[model samples]
Target: MNTTSQPSTADRAFNLSTWLVDRHVEEGRGDVVAIRCGGESHTYRDVLDHVERVATGLRAIGVRSEERVAMVMLDSVEFIATFLGALRIGAIPLLTNPLLPGRDLGVIIADSRARVLVISHERAASLDDIRAGASEIEHVITSDGWADFTASDEDGAAYDTWIDSPGFWLCTSGTTGMPKLAMHTHGDVKATFDTYATQVLGITANDRCFSVGPMFHAYGLGNSLTFPFAAGASTILEPTRPPTPQLVADIVTTEKPTLFFCIPTFLAALTNSDLPDDTFASVRYGVSAAESLPAETFTRFLERFGVTILDGIGSTEMLHIFVSNTPDAHRPGTTGRAVPGYEARVVDPDGNDVADDEPGQLVMRGESSASGYWCRSAQSRATFEGEWTRTGDLYTRSADGFLTYLGRSDDMLRVGGEWVSPAEVEGTLIEHASVLEAAVVGERDSSDIVRPIAFVIAAPGATVDDEELTAWCRDRLAGYKRPKRYEIVTELPKTATGKIQRYKLRR
Candidate 1:
């Protein structure tokens, strides 16, 4: 097992930066390259140097312990350094999605009451509006600001923050409303690394990690940042916030990563794109989360690139994947099993365990689960119940351990006296040769009955024929499960991490 700095209940210093950034250098792996981004390589020693600079920079700007340091930076060397740096000096780094609009960003800045915002040059374009709304911002650190901050000689003794102190905050996609912060402690990072990254991936220093999912998302946080860093492995940071298939293809071909982390939507795009069969030739495994991977997408990508995708479900509250498909137990359509150190149960609305094969809300109890959402008392209580975190996703567990995704609790459509899983319908729709991506939503018909409606994005050269698509679904899905109407769209609305925003389609 990979060794990491363990946490304790005693009042001891347990900064995540020491474990993820400084430990490698302390252990004589300083020469090992920790990160590769924007055509530059940073060794563990170099990363530590960057961490020190960020720490000193934050100090120079009077950032004290437990302060919120909002980071709106792109996926680059500075992102990891800044995140670790904040942890090093006992500040809470709030990671925001760079693709979020100025208004949402402004709201987050105000909500968190972040005094310092470390942003990229491109994202700083709307600084005026964001700053105007969030007067709490005392300092705005950019590239030029970073250069000066890092170059400065200002330094301080590393703060000995408690192990249970809020280490970082990840913004929930705000699918329901404005984004809320999921507060996780320093120990949470190590917990995810040990359970999912260690037991599942079995990553070693020789492995190279590349993820298309932006670091802001929970899956990507574990996949690209914590997983590799804790194992002393190298991670590839793609600066392109929303990476295109071709762009990702080029990175895989060039970076030659051993482990590839991506979402199902982008994976489908890569499979459907005209990219070469060996586009993912160097990837030994593809880790997928954020949403369920359709069986067709799983099979197609595997047949085309010889890369097996381990599709799993994780949440912001849970910190990372609590259940997943491992190498030995991978099933194309099922979420394999509860990850080591985590326990999962499918329970009904009343929190009673449903019989196997009965769909219910998934609740996970794990050490990596976030403490709770910051400042949302009612929501925090509702989502995080004592030791368990309710995922709000619908799933059916088999008699044994295999679990199948049904869809979100709200996403299950009641149609024609039977429940229809949008995932099941979407899976069938994407199986059609012409369909690239599909989203199924409920719509009331003329008879005031809820029916599934399909919105689809066509494959590269294929045209969406209503009849042909209907025929494809007709053969596969049940009469009630089939989409009542099909609407061809240019693109499905998605979050920055590529989770399909079904609410938008519903709207």
Candidate 2:
């Protein structure tokens, strides 16, 4: 392993694809298992061979350096190979969710101006609609046709000579508005591996990693692909859309992973499922991100299983989790202190630092932070100010350096002239025994005053009345923080990453 400090930018240039993919082959660890998917496994050498062949194929098709290649596929070996392959040949890969609506996908493809698109057969039917608007896409390839394109034995450019250029592009979750592509560099990739994965998470070659989030999302890209590759660790990929608890349990039993990456919604489902207590007995770490883990969900997960989840906060711009909880030093309700090499602060609207325990917007600076949003100059200027990126997230920092999420600044509701954090109200609602999940949003009343309204999913076989839930909240929460009305629903609308779409509820 290269234990030496990272080379100074002025002294040497490096490509992230070469650093992550070629290093294993160079170190003679090619025989080790690198990826496990669909009951099959591939060694590091196999991955490299595939990557080189794909790079050759891309080059043969006139994919020049810095050209954009977008991938709308599942979390499978093909996706991994294509992503690294594009980077290996000096092309920028755009990681996109395949399940996006056709209109949204067209908008993103048009904005990115991607030259080639790799999608699954199931999604190929939407190409006509997407291409009508995204005229720049010159070629489209499906997973079934991947082998035909990469059937050559042509050698790709040597890793040593690969251009040290920008890394893959990731779009924001679009929780606030239309998603923008965030441009990340190779330096940002290495920084995330060094600070978050190696220093904070302590991932090593012996640890088997499994991720529940889709690889298209930044959280999954780092947790499942980049971090494991950096450590020469094995990663398990479940290609099933909306993986069920039984599938996750089966993978845990078969793969025997030491590390598990997940989100709060999945954690809640697993906790409520009939899985045995020992399902996670072999697991060493349970990491949660992408959204705040409700305190009730955290407690329930710990009680149902013997593992404690390390909840953290990260953004697409940051590449990976910069503020996280180490397994040894975790606080249940708070996202732990900042990971090494990163700094965080809570500041008011005026950009002044707020006092401890005061709610304010979270602004962070780190080595892994992205350069800026691609092609969105105005948004980039508003978000990236000098060294810090304005997160638009509302949080409170304790004197002890722990961070507690309140809600998004725009998601906060003014009820009776007092600001109410929807997260707080939803957390309180989830604490009730009959509530499985809850989302709080602001609704205007007859007098044009905003009030808190809750949408809840009841526990299985547990009948919950709106009046009962309102009374339950009244008992535990203050007058202003309690929801004014409750609506029982079978499920809440969620993003692909499992975060509740609060905006949909407001509409």
Candidate 3:
């Protein structure tokens, strides 16, 4: 097992805030564009100046060490400045999706006891009710006047002595109920870049990173923000929600990024779009995570864009992708071998290793794994055991070391004493020409036995009937593995990160 201990004092002395901010200025790259948004570009020097001003503003507002500052703002230079500024002043920043409903946002704010809520003007209008419910939020900072608030010339507190303290919190994409806050230290941030970003992805200073995922999520936090800055590379930030296929294509064409970070849904959409072959001409690598990329999506994207999308699996707890397919050694259907500095295994419920090719829970240990969930002791203990974090994902490992993602362990189905992976069935369903997306859930039949049911979204201008889809699956899947029924839907319910909420489908 690869166990990570608390960072030594010497290790903690190298603060990520300094590495990402001051180092670039010293390297004479201050004038280079660090972030490009809609019509505005911020140089490294410009970003560092904002970070210092925001840090001073945060301290002036009485935000202290280890205080939680909840942020619900769009992706922009201001958002990055606020996050790094909180770190500079020894406060922990909790990044939250701005589009979340008021009730959900209230739950997060109340649970984290955030001293301040940083939000955009559009989102702030609807938060009056949420703020009323969240007693811990003492102040609200809107983006309309965000720049005015950070007009201070002070550099705030020096973080050199407090780098070991908790730095940030990411809310887990709870498959169940309310999301839990996962705590990470500054050391954890550096470790993610060293292991996953530098070692696995091999990002360099020349790479221009573009991401389709929101920075609030773990995947984006690591790939789009942390990794690029750690490598001294520039990133393109979109100020709105994840873009559509045409918009993404346009951004790639205009930005000419070398590294494109995305997820399966976006890949599928791009594959089905009318983008020309040269859309991704400048992109050296495309990466996918947050969910498994279907083999069909993988192949279609390769054929259309002539660039491989490396699929991987990760969680907010792990900070970033621990097991992944690198640019050179990617397999079409499997998330490749474990990255350097991580250990992984497929284990049964008893914690014993399962035979290769047998489906089992994936447990892993790595340096970048979060300390644990904040304020949820019982849940934290259940998830973070000593060195190993039991990822709720189920997978099967091949003899050669590639890992094939099945489905969430809770989403696994036992039908007629046989196991069924919803992802497998869903992947097969999407192979049909008319299906744009598919989700599977286990439902109880009239005989009180579990059965697989499928929800499908048809392709544009394509008509799909229940009988035809069922017959199509009958030829590909085993008799017992086939879905008992198929329902055509206009769209699949998805989280902000683009992951299908199968639990909602079950409900």
lDDT of model 2 at position 471: 90
Off by over 4 Å in 3: 1-11, 153-157, 161-163
lDDT of 2 by residue, 104-132 (tens): 78889889989899887778878887788
Q: What is the Å distance of residue 236 in model 1 from its true position?
A: 1.0
lDDT of 1 by residue, 139-208 (tens): 8888656788787677744678766877999998766557789999998988888888889988899999
- Per-residue lDDT for 76 in model 3? 80
TM-score of 1: 0.97
Candidate 1 colliding pairs: none
TM-score for each of the candidates:
0.97, 0.96, 0.96
Weakest ten-residue segment in model 2 by summed lDDT: 157-166
lDDT of each: 0.88, 0.87, 0.86
lDDT (C-alpha) at residue 77 in model 1: 87
lDDT-better candidate, 1 vs 2: 1
Give me the candidate number with maximum lDDT: 1
